[model samples]
Target: MLRRTAPCTQAPTTGTVLAGSLWHEAADPVTRRPGGPYGPLREPDVNGVALPEGFTSRIVARTGRRIGGVLWHPAPDGGACFPDGDGWIYVSNSEAPLLGGASAIRFGPGGAVVDAYRVLSGTNLNRAGGRTPWNSWLSCEEILRGRVFECDPYGSRAAMPRLAMGRFRHEAVSCDPDRGVVYLTEDEPDGCFYRFRPAYWGDLTSGVLEVLCATSDRGPVTWRRVPDPGGARAATRDQVGDAKHFSGGRGCHYADGLCLFATGGDDRVWAYDAERERLEVAYDAGAPPAAAEAVTPSGDLYVTRDGGDMEIDLITPDRVVTPVLRISGHPGSEITGPALSPGGDRLYFSSKRGPRGDASGTDGVTYEVTGPFRR
Candidate 1:
């Protein structure tokens, strides 16, 4: 039999401390019995990596049971960071559960539990979303026919699929809220970069869908929408490739001054100056993906699977990438969902559990690695 105490309190929030502190609640092994779900964190260890000195790891929420106010499914995928006045707004990309289903959740306005509500409802395969200056959510669907829905944090979320953003396997998005430009990435093996500039600033549904062609220099020459895959994804890929205007199809980011970061799945990150329309290699981590994120205030970046242990990495402004922690590549250890707290003290990440009968099993658990983090 397995039992978990009601969360004693909201997960602890701490001031910056080197080496960091692990939640006292941790230290017991969380286990589940036959016909039961996994339990809350216990006996959690850093595995092989030791806390730098004051840093520590804590299991925030685990699979199957009530965690952070909601019932976590088999696996958590993408995540986002939002500013909550003095605090921070954190969201999870609860991807498709191996068991299958879509349950939407929200946090911070109240507590962490997920209540069945209509704020942003009914969708599966939720991946990642970009933070908007207007403070809204642009959650993307990872399914073949998935849609991008605009979720407003304050009122009712826009339910229509912003078709102007172009249809494909939308994975991640970077928004230039200042200029109303939303840069998005497709998950195709050789996915393309897309740009959507609202007909009116802040309006997402109305915009120009353009692809990018990287110039010998960093400037991406524009290739407007050619065609959505009409039965031939390869041919459509070729279409975006050979078009004279073919350009701007790598994944990209839009930050202050409109600097765009896009990668080619070839393990390359590009920094493009939208205002100057010039491009430059940001960093070359190798392999495909270019799939990464930039944490604010500190301007640090965490790169995801580029053919290695689904490890968590921090990219410094000096062009150096450092490993913070690594979950084993073993089935239940593949790191997927990761989001930073406002203070950057805690990192929330998720991975799927092993199959019901698999040895190193899991249902998918979300963990909170706390302690001090530096740029």
Candidate 2:
């Protein structure tokens, strides 16, 4: 494989793609192998996964297939959907397919790269992430020792030690288009809810990161500062950089209007309706079970958990979390990375069926699950 290294600086100006836009087209100019606008999927019945009796799945694109200049590695965890011309684009959060793999890199099947800044290196454990109104991916490192990274439409990447997001085991993130703020969650035995207010709005390094503390009045709790839990307490933080700066915030998003979407160790989905200054359990997926991902689209709210009875949980607009998809894998292979197509017509998730160590083509797959998302 031809490997390249570039500085992680400068104003990322990827020619064709916009920092605040979406990517949805085929990578190569030749035959246009569309990335996809997938809906609920069905396993192949024989050796593949089976969808619900009535729903169906067709492979729009999968990992390990060569789309353009890059042969994508099997998706281990984390992904994002961007607009790429007439079609939609998909980027995986994976290590390089080869031995010394790179992280936070992407291919162009969904869109074309007209600029010189393509391919990124050295970001790790990138689990679930949210698309920014600015059209970038806020990729988080799941390893108790990881950094909250920012990937631009132009392909330039940077790591932010902005201690505001809390320094715990980070799982996922979601954005608020109107407020221009990002909500975060932590993944640990006991974690917390957090919010990162970009003091400079779009600027990465400069921002105020905060955590949520549920109020007893059943009203909106105040933002608690994530402390420098040093020594043993700092385990989640030191692995990446500073322990005092980061906190263990996990899965979250803007589910209903300004109401914050949150879930994690508590197995609980809470909606912190900021406008109303009240906190409510939109749904309790359950506690002990880790709620890794959740998002509020037009129809319902969806979340995935990594626990004994691993299953993807779904909550209706009325606040109901039902077990939708059961994942089949151990620790590293646990299911994660749930992203939506630009139109919100489809859903995507990543599973690493491969062993804990192996990185490339380990029989892992990036799944396309479309709707009518039914049982």
Candidate 3:
């Protein structure tokens, strides 16, 4: 099992870490034996999905369904959970080819969608993104020449672009609240791992964008700044002279003082220790990974499979990868987003093209699986 590092001296006031620390509880491999923390999954009682023995899944929202006077956005991708009054707010990204953006769904008691609406609009190919320490969503546009937009989860505010975060085919982001730094992943075959240090901590309007350059897999690394944050004329990698190239960067999550990121082309997960200035491989699945992933409060990593017997694989602190949930019927669809609730009892994700691989974006569905997860 990975050893625990010293906690950040500066306390975080926003994001998932503040919602509830996933590091407080340690996962017991024995308990995760036959099934996992919850138990062996049983055939879904409702949505045709499956989960660990005591878990239950419900369709929270579906594509083409009109809610809050708008069609529930399709191609649901990366998402994050934020604290609400007594429940929580789930902000989901819609990676539609056109008219792509983000949507918000408020869950009250008993995991019910009290309200849902479009939080971001007028963007092209909104893909995977992460939540900020300030309680906002960084909606990424996956186009070759795209930018990151900060959207309000409440849908009351307009989406703003943070050009300083760099213009690239962004896939995911993970924020280090205490240090006030944000890690971003590019989705290109030879993409680079980047970190944005805002001029003023917690402010994304201006920052220095730097790419990682490590001599070894485990490293005492260095960073090289991107000549241009707005990749209008050239990509960030082309501008950064010494940027280290990664393979098809995808999902990223921050937990236990480490920034964990995945690369689909490499089928590997990597961990970066910002404080220690080190990088290490966490897991190599030997196959292309799903577009989204989530880490439990207890430090377990869950990655969805891109194809071929779709399943959500669990990686323990000891780096043991096991298939926990097998997604049935979604032949050509990829499991896009996998997000855990603030309380750590619920898991939320979406099937990109829905069960039958519908190309019209009308068959996508967002689901919530509630169960006894390690807190």
Off by over 4 Å in 1: 1-50, 85-88, 97-121, 153-159, 214-220, 223-252, 258-265, 287-291, 305-308, 328-333, 352-362
Candidate 3 Cα misplacement greater than 4 A, ranges = 1-34, 288-292
Top candidate by lDDT: 3
Per-residue CA lDDT of model 2 for 164-251, tens digit only, reads 4555566667665456677765665555556677777776565666656553514556765444422246653233321112123445
lDDT of 1 by residue, 1-375 (tens): 000000111111111111101111122222212111111223325543223445566554555677544565545555554555444544555555333222334445323433322225567566565545555556677666556777654334444567767666666676655456777766666555567777887777676766656646344555566465332364334556543221233334454444344444444555545565545554444344324543434445555543445555554443345555555534334455455666566666655442231222236656666665653
TM-score of every candidate: 0.69, 0.65, 0.88
lDDT-superior candidate, 1 or 3: 3
The regions of model 2 sitting more than 4 angstroms off are 1-47, 58-67, 95-120, 153-168, 214-217, 224-249, 258-263, 286-297, 305-314, 318-332, 354-361, 370-375
* Rank list by TM-score: 3, 1, 2
Clashes of each: 32, 37, 4
Deviation from native of the Cα of residue 109 in model 2, angstroms: 10
lDDT of 3 by residue, 311-345 (tens): 77675655455666767788878776777776677
Q: Could you tell me how far off, in angstroms, the CA of residue 47 lies in candidate 2 after the best superposition?
A: 6.0
Best by TM-score: 3
lDDT of 2: 0.46
lDDT of 2 at 358: 41
Global lDDT of model 1? 0.48
